[model samples]
Target chain A: MDRSVLSIIKCFGTELYNALKDAQDDISEIRIRKEKSVVVYKQNIPYAVTKQGLTALELDNAKNEYITVSEALIKDAFAQLCSYSVYRFQNDINNGFITVNGGHRIGICGTYVGENGIMRSVRDITSLNIRIAREYKGCSRKLADIAGCEGGILICGVPSTGKTTMLRDISRLFSTEKMLKVSVVDERGELSAYSHTSNGFDLGLCDIYCGYPKQKAVICAVRTMSPDFIVCDELTGEDIESVCFTVNYGVKMIASVHCDSLENGLKNVSLFRLLKTGAFNKVVFLNRSIIGKIDAVYNIGDIQKLYE
Target chain B: MNNMKIIGAVLIILTSWLTGIMLSKRLSQREELLIELKQLLSEIKRRITYEMPTMCDLISNCGTQYLKPFTDNMYNSLSGGYTINESVISAVADTPLLCVLQDCEKQLITDVLSSLGAADSTSVREITDSAIIQLDHYIGLAQENRQKNSKVYFVTSLYIGFAAVILMI
Candidate 1:
């Protein structure tokens, strides 16, 4: 079994785990909503696996057909993801996701507990979406070549659109084949797939700064690791500033953002500012239906024109 | 007939000495456990202050002897989605090393572990730091007790065993 799948199985209660293990190849996500049917995401669709190892087309097929996710099971699975210590994962839980070993991302949903506009912890968790991470080696090779092989590249896609997977492979490629020193700012441990207990993805020759936010990681990676390129996943708050800081120091970067269209991507105020600052050379957009297929590639010229 | 009596007398003496050794071993173990716990808490404090290491990393790297069972139990149970406190409580309860400890010592260890992995960073730091300080007193008491009690146990065991033999004779 893949290490990611193994983690899921270990978190799953015995009966559900056995059923999923019987048909592991067809599985992608294991979604558990409190007191609701356990819906396993497979083939880009959700299916309910029965106790007899039979798969139903939909969760609403029949009450007895789907696995019933228990509150205890959800709590147990959440604890496992946190490594049995919520204190360790408090920040990540506040952010509503925990990256497990092998780069799998567990999207958490729970009662937000915090103090004065800050998310301190997640309590009374109601649902968990375990998203399995897949690596497609050489998937971004053509896109990288098209987007200009030497400078900055940003992969843009919606959730589950292979943004992180592409970054992981690209980091692996550049660091291994080209012999470039790549630093991965794995704020969420997604890109490097670094689990606390075991390493998830192997980004050969890349120095990863796990758990550090983008703003700090970019500066630290450039100053300490002296990488030729820094790869990261997701451009969120304060990320543009970090990327700009790296650009000023003459270090290249490969990162991703959440968006689908070329226009919307560049038109994003922060991203537009980042493009204008010459932080990224190209924005490579991906279609979730086609995995790594580059639906559009917008160069600096195209991106700059958006501001015009 | 003389040789049999001589052999019996030697056997009784040997048994008394063995009993003394066994009696003293518990006192020494209690002392050692306190020292080890102090060290473990210090290590945890250092790790948290400098780096955010996983509980598994902390336990696996530092876990030794009697603490090994606790770490092992916790490591296995954590993967099963059990809470840190619940797993650790079970681990401590199940560990043979802890079974030899006094009730107060066991309670101290439990309180220390309860807050170890499942709290906020600030709280974890505070707990570990306080544990290190409190464990120093425990270590000192255990050391002093070991010094006084080990000899006491050994002498008492030796005399008791030998006196029984003498009384029988």
Candidate 2:
């Protein structure tokens, strides 16, 4: 079991903690909603938590016995997540999620309290989705060649297709195996999960910039760390300007984008713009069947010519 | 026989004087503790305005000797998953030095601690500022009591001792 996931489970009610503790290694996500059955997702399969153990909850079966999450449980979990100090997590609460010490991102939903149309905080929380972070050490070994001999590679995949996990391994391999100075711009702290309580995954020889905005972190890394390559997750349209600017500094880039298929990836304006900068020469499509498996690798020029 | 009587009279006066000093020190100690609390609240306000440390950091890292045990108790209770109010109450009960505080003053301190880490920076600043003012009032009252009664305790206890000695003689 991931130590961070275990620490998180300890924050739950005793019964829930015991029920989930034994199966934490295989569990990926824990969905907690107020006054509802707690659901744990293992290998993308949903199971309702029961005292005996995890039971596969069927959609048509209304009589399945499961522990229903209460308001008190939700309140206690929120307090524990905040470390009993709500003021410390106010900014994260305003953003609708709080990342715990081990890089597990907890998605929070609640009534929004706003001032001048800007969110100040969230109250009366209705649900929390705790996404566990798992490190697959050799997950990117198959892509070691592509990761190492890269001008730039755009890894595209849908949500839950293991893009982040692949990125983490590739980062570790590049830093340790290839003996390159790699910088991970961890905007959401997911990549590094560096907190006071826990030092997250070992991305060997990689300099992690946690909780930095992607563009700013890239600029800082180039100026300060002088890393051979910069890796970041989930680039959107807003990052195009900075990414393009950073690539001009002779540093390589490895980034991910959200696209379900190769055709749509070429159609993505941000991906097109990113490729037009000549930063990325190849696009690697990841498959959901086996995480980190490259479905196809396309040359940017060939794809452009074919599409045109 | 005369030397023994002189020694006994001297012992009575000294013991009474010592008792007076001990009684006066209690009020002074309360005054000093109130002053420390005011300083702590001011420091808390400054940190909230500038550094914005979490409650755990604020309490556990506070280096003041008098409040160290008190804050340590609170820190342990919070880490043990106790509620804010419960932590403060437990800390107060566990701390011997805080027992010097009057009931109302302790209640005010409890309110200040309970309110912290439960709100935003602005609201927390306001709470600490308010707490500082109330602490200042308590300090003033304690100071006045110490100033007014310290001499009386010494003089009255000495007079009683002298009367006892004279009657014995």
Best by TM-score: 2
Q: What share of the true interface contacts does candidate 2 keep?
A: 0.49
lDDT, residue A96, candidate 2: 78
Interface RMSD of each: 2.1, 1.8
Q: Model 2: what TM-score?
A: 0.90
| lDDT for each residue of candidate 2 in A1-308, tens digit (9 for 90 to 100) | 76667778777778887787777477778999898888888777899988888998865547757877778778777877877667666767777788788888899988988888977778788899998877889898887675455577788998777888888988999899889889999888887787776678778889998877888899999999998889999998889877887778988888898988878876878777877787777788988666567898888888879768
Please, what are the lDDT tens digits per residue for candidate 2 over residues B22-141?
Answer: 888888889998998888787777776776566777777663544788888988987787877899999989989887789999999898888786776667878888888888888899
Off by over 4 Å in 2: A59-64, B1-16, B45-54, B64-66, B160-169
**Model 2: lDDT of residue B112:** 89
**Residue by residue across A203-256, what tens digits does model 1's lDDT show?**
878898888888888888888888899988888746777877888899998988
Candidate 2 CAPRI-style tier: medium
Best candidate, lDDT-wise?
2
Q: What is the DockQ of candidate 2?
A: 0.54
